[model samples]
Target: MEFGLSEDQVMLQETIRRFVADEASLDTIRAIADQESGAQNVLDEKIAALGLDGLLVPEPEGGSGLGVLDAILVQECFGYGLVPSRFLANTVAAYAFGASGSELAGNIASGAAKFGLVLNDVVSRRDSSGIQVSGTSVTGKSLMAINVRDATHLLFYSDDAIHCGAPDETSVVKTIDRTREFFEVAVAGADPDAKTADVEQVFAVASVLIASDTLGAAQAMLDKAVVYASEREQFGRVIGSFQAVKHLCAEMAAKLEPCRALLWHAAHAIDENDDEAITMAYLAKAHMSDVATFIARTSTEVHGGMGFTDLVGLHYWFKRIGVNRQLFGTPMVLRERAARQQGLVA
Candidate 1:
């Protein structure tokens, strides 16, 4: 009946937390962001050294074969650091490929290949953009393909099946969040084999991971706001002494704390293959999106004008939360999906 992280889970979280603190500090992330190439390569090396590249892959595939919850913990740490890496996309890809018994899963687990994700069409397809599969050729465009930089393979949905293909031509898409990269990929005559995995299960796993990322980012913002309030002074008194600032920080903590538990439960549901796993994933994503947005805004307000400045660097977490809200599905879209799953909508 223990409703919390196990001792090993706590240790795992702390290990990644320390690594982020030492290796992916704000300055370090800024330096990597400014680089033109080899940035992700460096990160991949570090992650592989930590044996994190294969966190979700099966043991037979050289991975630890951990569950979704363990992956969630690692992703939360990445979010807190705002580390610009493809851990999110790669983890999901590993799960998908592993579930389907794809050979590429071993490459991913062994760090021999990187997998990018182009499943936006699965959530909400745009008439103007999508991957078209014809025979052995895949053609068309995906406006928002994630982790495409330096990816050796792309997982996308086409012709009512999940297809893995090598990216043909890709262009970076600029966004407010610089911590992660987005690309517009043009698929042309790539691999045509459709891997067999539960599409709904993959989507659910992706949603929970995204929600966990936001949870970590929100927690970072709240911690930063608290630290800033305790140090910054107004009218010869620290802002932390003010009831307004205290309430802002308190509200952020209160709102963000529950999200962690919600995400944990949702992730556990995925591992257990519970009947409500899909519904819980949708609900967790929707709730975290809304609450994290509130915490991002309130945390920024607590820092005043400095929050918007580069010196404070609060915008990194803020922008991360913003981008996460739109990824996969927005709160409104996810809420409707949850309703549909629960038979509350026609």
Candidate 2:
């Protein structure tokens, strides 16, 4: 089946593209990454200024009450710009709370308390509690955890409900970005009142969002590679003159287009409440995870050694895709789920 974006969807994509071009340019993102400071809050306000925060929440929750497709659009743009904010976390949590009939929905819709959804295997079966979460906030020490350092409320899951202290320097471990530490949060006594039953549902959205982000990052890498191939000289002619380069570019596009179609198919299925949504969502994520990683790596190949340096910005997307792949669930895990659904045995 052919999938295409509606006129409204096209407009949304364009608006977001313009915003990223104007506000979160390569220079801007580089500056933020360089400082090791959290720019998610600042960027979140900018996105709020665009009125995107209300897209996923219900009308009763002070939002525009659109749907997941809108959220997918925002997710795509966020990936394109590499804005490391709690937007994804907040969106999923707000939706989960709305699903659970919790008062937190309103706060989430208004961006009052930042919500970071934790979907790691270590905590997937756990329940929420009042304990403090002391650890890393933004960097790799948290290993794919989003905006953990700046989060005010964390939607945590585990074998049972437990409390974790608020994150701080001592609790988190330092990694790629020093200012952003990944903390190993410890949980304490159960608090039934603090737990919510919406963890699985929220995780579904988180996985989908991460997949969408990877899609954007992959597109960026492909675009860069194509441009470099056409402009860079080898021996006496452009590298684009080589059949090998042409074939690689073709392979990149081949991987990207199908992933895009699968993504929209999954997003639409979920929005329309179709039974096929889950299967499609997992398939899309798994496929995109591989494609995003390949695009990043191959783009570096197309650009030669120049791509490895920070000046090229190729590594940023490469690293981001690597981290994104592991979040919610790895590509291998999603593929296994999809395969099982298809009744394919290993």
Residue 150, candidate 1: how far off, in angstroms?
1.2
Instruction: Give the per-residue lDDT of model 2 (tens digit) for 1-346.
Output: 5568888888988998888878887776776776634454566578778766556778887877777777887788878777665667777766666655556676677767566555564322224322333332122222234567656676655443322223433254444532223444432222344455544345566678879988988888899999999999999999989999999888999989888777887888877877667667777888889888888888889999999997887877888788778666777887776676567856
Deviation from truth (RMSD, Å), model 1? 1.6
Per-candidate count of clashing residue pairs (backbone under 3 Å): 0, 27
lDDT of 2: 0.68
Question: Weakest 10 consecutive residues, lDDT, candidate 2?
Answer: 134-143
Model 2 misplacement above 4 A: 36-41, 122-144, 160-170, 173-183, 186-199, 339-346
On TM-score, the leading prediction is 1
Per-residue lDDT over 1-346 for candidate 1, one digit per residue giving the tens place of the 0 to 100 score: 8788889889999999998898787877776666647665776678768878788899998888988999999999988888766777778888888766777778887888787889878778778888888877777998778888778888887766677888889989888888777888986565645464477788888899989888889999999999999999999999999998888898888888888999999999999999899999999999999999999999999999999998888988999999999999999999898888889999
User: How accurate locally, in lDDT, is each candidate?
Assistant: 0.85, 0.68
